[model samples]
Target chain A: MQFSGDILIEDEFLRDGLQNEERIFTLAEKLEFLAALEAAGLRRIQVGSFVHPKWVPQMADTDALCEAMPRNEGVTYTALVLNGAGLDRALAVGLGHLSISISASETHSRKNTNRSVDEGRAAITPVIERALSEGVTVRAGIQSALGCGFEGRIDPARVIAIAREFAALGVQEINIADTAGLANPVQVFDLCRKLQDAIGPDVALSLHLHDTRGLGLANMLAGLQAGVRIFDAAMGGLGGCPFVPEATGNVATEDLAFACEEMGLATGIDWQKLRAPVARAEALLGRALPARQSHVPSPPWLREVA
Target chain B: MQFSGDILIEDEFLRDGLQNEERIFTLAEKLEFLAALEAAGLRRIQVGSFVHPKWVPQMADTDALCEAMPRNEGVTYTALVLNGAGLDRALAVGLGHLSISISASETHSRKNTNRSVDEGRAAITPVIERALSEGVTVRAGIQSALGCGFEGRIDPARVIAIAREFAALGVQEINIADTAGLANPVQVFDLCRKLQDAIGPDVALSLHLHDTRGLGLANMLAGLQAGVRIFDAAMGGLGGCPFVPEATGNVATEDLAFACEEMGLATGIDWQKLRAPVARAEALLGRALPARQSHVPSPPWLREVA
Candidate 1:
């Protein structure tokens, strides 16, 4: 219940945020966002994903975007890579950090990757091994680790098994994703505690939460109580699982960062500066995003009286 | 951290929800919502507020709506009354429960009711006494109890003093409202715990939270952790403080109930059934509401497989 300590927030705006939008963002627009995000003091950012253009048209220019990204000291840029081809693309672009993920739910795994959970695990293991062997920092993720749209109530033991597998593969971090956002605070706390116990402390555990059910921040609180320090958030709360029914955005970066700052946790994020990217995204999308802090000005209490 | 036991959720859709909305709903429409809420197993419902029509045009027909409301068994219907005139109106309407509230912040008090904090307190003291004399169930509330948008941070001592004043007057409940939605979970927990210690167990403390910065549910969780059981929510998350800029809806009734049920707490609310009223509200308002559960279909995990 006591939240004290520093937390690392990984902004996935350019990747997860833009992947689901119908209109594909040009390279220039993405670079503009990247610059804004970097300028906002986000130390960790997911630039984009190495996915097939046929699968995710919005992410077709991930390689080009990565090649054009400016290398900044003290900033870690990551990208999601699903398969061997995606890994090859990431290596070709000389990306240092790569996220390799598979769904914990069999139904979700097949639907998302066109492979069963076992096949998906088998496929990602080699990619993870290859990435780690090449000195690339790998973050292995278990998608739908909490629950699934097609498959109900994913077992915690299964998620723990995947986390253990990822840990044994020598990944730097393991992420438990509430891909469908079917997670409550109690479940999040219990599952995160169990995962922490299962994986031990050497491997860092991160949470990728969605706000589909409005429990995203509450769940994040639970994760914090359970000893998680890394979280994935998107600017303007953009991003959703296309395969999941009625899936909304990830927990908004500004909102999450604001909560962290309010809780006395050091996130090294200038949450106020995040409004620029969110505003730009809103303009490009031609609609107001769901991020609450982005739309509402900070209350007087949060500001310094001159 | 442990949230167990039964909780009381007072649905304020008819009162708080409609107050800030631009279009005024007809009495028949309100009655329909009342019936829907009742049928959805909501035992406590705030029908509307007895206020000047010039101030809140949406609640003009509160007395008529109260008159037409069916007297269901075991149901507690309440109305918000701001002053002597509003109390007289409630008495004339033969209402059994009334909420007399004042802002804890001086600036908010003056802006909201045209009275300073002390003046607002003095003005409401006689109304609370009169209502108690009439054997009316009274809920004395401190608006902006946690933080104020205009005045910034409200001192916790002020809120406790007001609660003590109300308790001394034999009020049935003390409600703490985050009118500006600026409360963080840590502050909410610490303050609620302090208030509980100050007030003792005889009087119940309920939380009235807004989702302005997307922290409503998280703050609710903190309240639960602090051992305060009663809460106020609105159908489809309808409601915002007009005095507070960019204030969004109250915590969604369905979302709050869903979180409770998922956490193994009994709320006596048929959350799925309440979607009917939410759909109707959205239709009438001509916009999607902020409630997450209402917009998204319950995932397969929540539904029983036939």
Candidate 2:
């Protein structure tokens, strides 16, 4: 299997990374992370989500954070929006890119969004249409596309069907998420390949993976082999599945970049520059994160190999 | 990229896992761990290394541990030996399987074993010969075969040449080690394929990987794609390279087994049974280990996926 020549990394540290944590980052701290991410040459970043403060207290200041964020050239700053109200909030902040996602598992949809699978899809349709009519970049996402903690073994056919609907709605990208970290390499490769075939390459495919079972990077490697070039990662691996107790975070941004760069794929990410932010995050959390690359010194062979 | 249907796992938690930690396990605790491992269906285990206590104090009781270890049916117990003296000690205990290894990097060889590459090879030749004459199963190892901390970018040809020498010595297996955690997936696949071609199918190949940079399992996936079926892992991801500060441990045995089992490969090991021992190790170490599988609950999809 041939790998892509370059990879696109979208860091979701402020959003997914912090949403599940008990200690919330203030607006100032979020901006600090944003500046560091931009300076480190990360082209895509998810600032926060526009969910209700009552539901997700950590994301209460997404609008203020987005308004305060600098608009760097060549960098696309996005936020997650789950409904029309969240879309209105994101658009009010003049955000160009927005992620609107629904869960494939009916049980997960009900638990996460208080809507059944059909209800969730119906609710997001108008949000996507409104975003598209306003010329906003829409990244349609399918959560629990690989598997779910509540409803195990989400069918690939269901995921592809959801993608087909999102494609017909004229979205620019489709992101398949292994929300519960239940995906293996073979399942990832198979589902990704089938999705690519069904989507016919018009809509870009990206993956949002979690590292709960220690197969996150391995599954990412399989996704790469299946022709996926874009991935969502979090700094310091700081995220967990709120639905699954003790589930780990997304793949670490530095670790993902290191793996890609080591395999001759240009990620345009400076892993060395990520250390300060990761260290700050660790200090603030008063605990160590699950990230490996940020903690260890760069090996001497990376320069020679990459 | 065809994976082998059956995989072999050699757990080295007792040796590589504990050697670098400050805490030491008594003979009784080690026996408990050994019993747990045997009950968990581990076929091959590396109990400890026959090194001088002055260097690795944690392994000071290896001889006594070996003598007291029960000879379970269908289980192959082994220990590491660095020279003729270590070999003699291992022989004195009647260890059926012994691992004799050298470093591929000249600088690492000098630092780790206090000998040049040639001298290290010359010193181990008689040990290998003696072990062969005693009808012991010899697993010849090449450390820093992928890259080194002291001297970076070890040539794959050098690793192949060493494997050839080991094969000529009539060793049963050749284990390639990424001593400094500098190996990438492409490098691992290419080197393992070349080593397989050079050493032929008669000599088995196993990989000893570290998760220092978080590429261990990904590299293991690449090795599997390259047709390697045997791997060395530590429970609770307990091993670290003594030469590299802040370097992490080996790939977790449960994590590796979970991945293999998820990918339709039979590992003949029960990952669930490993939790008790891993928890014990964590408690004894007074810290959380780098293992993901032992911390998280088994996903409901594993039963359906596998």
Candidate 3:
């Protein structure tokens, strides 16, 4: 039960959340969401990805979003950069934070980024070096670290090796992602222990989880018990894996915040304030989002106790 | 990290799953679901309730369902009985297992059953006596033991007192329910430990949880860590509290089972076989159900690793 006193939750609704969404958001709508997230007290936010527009039209407005988003002194705004071109685009927009990722599973690596795992690993050094030269905070993510849709079970050795590579590059953080959302708590606990051991204490560790198997929050709990303090979550459980149509996106931001708050951990995000953007997203999507707090009406009693 | 080696998951899909559905299912469909649950290797199931048909038209054909359900020697089928009259009906139908429950919160007691908490407590003794006299296995449940919709937070001491009462009546099992789904892992862990200590080990403890707050599976993990083995879940996450239309019903059986299997816990239920019933329920309800495994395709890799 011994865990961190404070947990940092990075809102990835605009990046991982909206990446695969069919409905594209305009620059204004994206800015609105950014404002809302900032207002809700989230310190770190992943605005969008710098992938090709043809592949992921949902995030085509990354440059515009980055340029127009309000700059707060304390808030750290990051963008997902897949390769050198993505890093170039992020640099052009004066973005200070960049997250670069490669899948741990070979099949998923090729399918997602059109590169083999080895190629993906080799490509990271220059990108990290370029971004770091520009004084940008870099986060290296290992996707499908637990399992994969196309490749099935991913080896933990691959994930640990990737963590070592990221550590050698002196990245600020290493993100272990359950890309296919197929991880269990025991796997999370065990793998996190290994990764923490391999990566050493100098680099921070974060987890990016998908709720595909309904284990998102449970995995978060496991990660916390295993000494991980940073997590990635979506606003309204938006962004399902396109590979698995039935899979939910990242864990809902409000839901994770509520769970952490109830566990006596400090997240510093107001769970109640998250409802507005979630409601707006549901209305825009014209469907109910899978976030638990979105459906629950705020009763009068909650004000006193919650 | 110490938990039970095996968990007993009781499928309450028929009673709690369908109670709040706008659609009314025929007796034959209910039988189909029942057979599917049996085929899936669930040892315990809650088939229906004996509440007044006028109050809950969805389960109007409980009598006929009880009379015609397939009898499996290996499976234990049970039913919910709210009052003496319902118990009389269960006895008349020759049902061997019955569950009787009362709310721990006074406001919820008055709202749901039209009785004060004390009155509800007073009523259980005679009902338990009658069921035991008839050689029936009676399970006593305390609803709102974690929280209540009407009253918000409920005292754990009230739950302990009720467990003591059920123990005095020599009931076979006691169920502590999060009727409003307001429970967090810390609360679940603390309260479960208290309940187990107060109720002792001879009387088996079960949990009836609503996924209203999206902590269904997380709370299940907590309960497992706290030494609770038996849980109540509905197929496809059916049955929200009738009063709270937005609140989800019990945790989805397939989702819970999948998570348990991944964690190396023996539930003994064939997780793959649950798809048919869940799909059928969705078709009957004419909407997508929230069972995670129902949507995930069975990959060949799952056979080797999962």
Candidate 4:
């Protein structure tokens, strides 16, 4: 159960974090935040989602963001695409990195994407192939992989089968999301182990966790024990699961980095630098966020050492 | 690791929860909450503390609380006794169970109890012996066992020595508390494993955690993986570390139970039964508490099944 290496965190604050927020930032504001995240030494950033403006107005400036933000040599900037139209927008906007996301649970797939799991699966086939052919690194993610509100507990076999399909299609990574925030440490360790075994170390595994039930960091610990290296988190714990209003969405990036650092895992990014962006988001949103460490002033002991 | 059996949780809301709150509950109110907790199936309840009321006015009515609350056949009611005087108070009130607690960090010991670590350790010797001699079940706890605000991190050897002394005194159990909420998952796992090995399972191991850095439940998970069962949690996330105002104290009792139940561990208490008491506390305090599961109305899926 030793964590041997550095973990790569993909900052999803711009996409998943802002999507559910009622206050939509302008293109300039979004770009400035992106630059700040990059300056904070984040290697991967989910800049935006190519979703319709009507459905998710917060992400309406996806094309504008991709067009304006400067690309860095070492950084990987990705955007989420749910269907063919969203994919077309990503390609049209010259998105260099892409994620094709669908739910593993049939009920969640139908309600969220208005398609059956099979249809959603079949639809992403061409998207993955096209992205690969276009020299784009693709990440295939299964939402509600652990459990769903409407579907109760999702079967490990079903999530594994979807990951196998994505692995066969040559996607760079496979992501498992606890969309309903129902995963416990035991369940997370079990699923991560099985997924790693099924994928055979060829495809990278990522975990997207929620703190809805206050188990986000705990699940992340279990994932680390299971040898997972990539995690998706939002700054200031900005997002909330749309399905569960009171449920805080993605794990806070600063909190996760702090926890990882404390565990002797390298995260490259400075945990202290996360507070500025978190404060900015809080002021922009005009509310106190739920991330614990961000709200705390650095004590003298930590400050002196840092 | 598989978690097969049940876990015992000590409800510390009445004591630790209120001690840190600015609002104080009346003796009648405290008794009403105690009855509700018993009805909720909590086997172990820390009703109040035997601290000087002048120092901590919130626990001023501990005597009245202990005298009024009805005792159940299977339930074990406990009070925290910080010194010999506190132990005498407990004996006078007929409190059956008592916890002798002091800090593992010397700096924290000096600040909190006005004594050095060694002095605090020496002071508890006769307290433990007296409690045991009088047929009282004694739980010896080491506060700030993981890390400290005044002292950055506590040495495992220091904590282990304290536990050894308590074990030699024939205490019923030994508790390791994350008093400053400075613990991470790795620290928790290591300390729990070391304490369990040193105590040799004859003395039951318990953990008292605070959600100061949002790692309370995560630490709880790591502790579970390390095979420690008994936990101390507060209802409605009602407390914060007195040393750090921003640091939320105990893990919310309802949240821990819900997380344990999700992980297939029986907590004896139903998660659904937690809200009424949480609401009562919130109303009495006239504020919204930080507990997550308490605020979330149980959806149909969880309700029908439970």
Candidate 5:
């Protein structure tokens, strides 16, 4: 009952959502999504991932995305960078906000990059330093923060240790990811609490969860109980890891916003407005999006109150 | 930290699972699904709903299903009854168990069944009494237990009152349903605790959650945490409600069981064997079932151990 008011949510649909599309959109189509994100009152959006074009052809437009993004005076548009090279490319395109990821599971880290987790960490630390040097706000992500399909359960201790390193490296934020949908509410709450305890409130705690096990929103609510103010979600549940194997989309942005808003927690988002991005993306994907809010009969309140 | 084991999940594919199929399965196909359910190690299942053929033509084969169901020892096959007439039909068909539903949201009750919550309750209480006299196990359900699209928020108090009344009527179980996916972990945990307070351990607590908002498994976890056992899920997530309009499928039974088994909980159901049911349903629906576990490769542990 104590939980109320608008909470900040970060939309990862562009970077995370584009993973599920059968047909990769033109850079223009991708920007259409970004413009919709801006119009939806979303304060933060991850527009593109800086992975190599050869590896993920869908995200080949990352450089162009940064240049073409709809500029909102207060909105934070982010480019997800892998290492220093990706960070440099994002920075050269006038991208001032950045996210770098390191997998908590060693197996996943090695699969994601040909390096071990520690090596991935070694690679990302300098990007954090460089982002700070360039005055680019950096949010360092601990992928597989909850569990891994390849390696199974990830150690919360490793996640905490990584967060401490990121905090020390002056990363602007820390996003903990349950990359494999293996997280439970207790684990999510516990991890968020521990990460916050280690890093304090200076770094925002952003949670990225998957719907793989039906714990996506449950885990988000648990993190909310642990005082996490930020979340990552996709439009129309479009996004999954090309590497995480069975991974589906991130928690859908509109669904998350609806849950938070209806529960009296403010998401600063209009759920009705959030549908546009997914609808736009549907043209690119051909198939309908996975899950959608029920279309039950007209709510009398919507008509009467308004 | 106390939660462990595979959660006990009951597949509802036969009864509530066939709401909007383009074509109803013949008694033979339905029998095949039941066959798969038994092989999946399902100890409990809802095989049919005794509603009017005109109202729900897809379920017109209720009596046929009762006759053709593969009789397996110790597997509890239940049927849904909407009114006294339906209950009479179920009793005539020799159903051992019955599930009766009353909505927590008055608006939904009126629109869905042309009765207010109290009137719907009135119409069903005698059915509960009549079923009990015949030694049939009657489980009362509070539908729209979370929130209703038409009604907005469902008061936990109303749900408790419905649950309390049903418990007093000698019902064998109480199912708290997120008829709409408007529940979060907090709401689920809190509501389950209240439901337990109203019904206690003598009457089993069941959950019928829809994945409309992707919170089905999360709500199920909340029920488990609150000491409620027994869950209702659909195979391959193949369901939507023609009654409610655009309702998503029940929680995926395989996905739920996998989550539960991995956590070391005793569900007494075989997770691996349930894949066939999913496959059969997918073929029947002429589309892929919407389940995360379906897309996943066999875990290395399973292969290594095998």
Candidate 6:
């Protein structure tokens, strides 16, 4: 009863999990996985990215995956687009939910997207405009929003500025990404509070996190106390960036669900359906992932384990 | 600047880490590991438990470990005990710092120590007397203190009764343990606040946590905000209760230290130096021990890789 609110979970297993693979899934495999997500009641999913396949062959079937994903009345399917060009492709597919990312650290923005923070800002402007005109939802993700492995420390003001810019550009949501998992709870609480005060809830906030330094959930908890309701997670903790060395995986969906339920926060997720996705993911990856789902006898574990 | 006070790190790698082992470490290895902990600037450690070896064979050598541990000027070494017999062994070894535990739930207490809640209470009285007479620093650990895996939920009043008991015993400290990892942050903060209000800080409070569900550090952060300090952690994410099947490891010491340091809290521990003990543990286990150390750098791969 202490946590009196509902939390939303969005799955990124397909898009993020693909990054850690050696071979791209065939169209059939991608469709099978997408269908599995739908059957499992994984409502909102970032199914794939619209970047060039030459650079990220792992997401080669972005277009096909988008077209093949089963639709549900209550579900929202999303795709990641780092720039205007990718947004164009996503728009062509009639995407209503879109995510655009720019690392808060100037160095990461340049290396990952070949743009400085300012240039990244300029690039995302058109995408935000298109989304508003097309009546689509845009969420600007400040990558490496918490800490920069390469930089040692990240300026929280830089992230706040980026959130402010996206808010001005009509972005409906803001995601603070711990791209390298360098954030602790205090930093998370402080930074989330700053973003919350700046945006005043005009832009809904979510966190796309990594378990790199193992404070992923701690950071999320801090964000939750700051009024964050949406979270991005992967099943079986499967997902990491192939381009980024040492990128482990996204915070596991099952683990986050467990924490929320125990806190009396409602996530509207049936964790039993998630286990099959985890098993399927491990089979696809040909190995177990980093973080395992908790073995507690919560509703999900009861259904899955028993 | 917002976070007040020094960050204290108490390593339980020797005591708790040994719980999850398929094959326990040799006494020589434990001694070597203790030396490594001191070298890492760890000023306090829960070295071993004085419980009956029949219950936890991994800790049968508690006496040998205490006798062999290299004593230091500022370092404080503590041992976990159950009753007078264990206290006698600790006193014989000249250990001033000691921990006694009883599960908050009657069911778990019965299974954990083969004694009912009231029965467990009756047994520890003589143990407390001996420790107080010897001028020992005593910490009464109340386990399953938050929520239980066996029992559905725990009442805060039960915990209050235990705290009142410890206070009456003239014990110096109380450690609230989420033995089954059932706590969420809100529950943690509320419970700690209630416990502190019921029993003033006559007994300095600490937390011993298990990450069975990945909310270990989150719960600890909540306790800190509630004005509770002192905690226990094992190295390399190793821990479990032999009696509690499939219980996960304790919060990893290196990971906890890194989290506190990142939060700008001072935990008087050199995480970089803490690596040696973990390495020894991994080598002996012949499998990678899951922890945050060497897992991933902060964020912004752009800088670290550059």
List TM-scores for all candidates, in order: 0.97, 0.97, 0.95, 0.97, 0.91, 0.94
Considering summed lDDT, which 10 consecutive residues are worst modelled in model 4 chain B? B240-249
The predicted structure with the larger DockQ, 1 or 4, is 1
- Supply DockQ values for each candidate: 0.76, 0.63, 0.51, 0.64, 0.39, 0.52
Per-residue lDDT of A1-306 in model 1, one digit per residue for the tens? Answer: 467789999999888888888989999999998888888788899998888889888889998988898989989999999899999999999999988999998988887888999899888999999999999999999999998878768999989998998999999899999998899999999998988888888999999999999999999988988899999999889988767756689999999999998988999888888777788788889999999998887878666721
Q: List the residue pairs that clash in candidate 6.
A: A148-B299, A149-B299, A150-B303, A150-B304, B7-B266, B7-B267
Model 4 clash pairs?
none
User: Which is the better candidate, 2 or 3, if ranked by lDDT?
Assistant: 2
lDDT of each: 0.90, 0.89, 0.85, 0.85, 0.79, 0.79
| TM-score of the first chain in candidate 5 relative to the native first chain | 0.95
**CAPRI class assigned to model 2:** medium
Interface RMSD of 5: 3.4
Candidate 1, residues B57-123, lDDT tens digits: the string is: 8888998887888888889989999999999999998999888999999988988899999999999
* TM-score of chain B, candidates 1 onward in order: 0.97, 0.96, 0.96, 0.96, 0.95, 0.94
Which CAPRI quality tier does the interface of model 6 achieve? medium
TM-score of chain B of 2: 0.96
| Better structure of 1 and 2 per lDDT | 1
Interface RMSD after interface superposition, model 6? 3.8
lDDT of 6 by residue, B187-257 (tens): 88988888787778676878888887778888878877887767788878788777666457888888887
Stretches off by above 4 angstroms in model 3 are A1-4, A241-247, A303-306, B2-4, B243-246, B303-306
Clashing residue pairs in candidate 2 are none
Worst 10 residues of 6 chain A by lDDT: A294-303
Docking class of 3: medium
Q: Once superposed on the true structure, which residue ranges of model 4 sit more than 4 Å away at CA?
A: A241-247, A299-301, B243-246
2 against 5, candidate with superior DockQ: 2
Model 5: fraction of native contacts: 0.41
**lDDT per residue as tens, model 3, A187-278:** 89999999999989989999998888778988888888789999999888886655444446789898899889878899999878888899
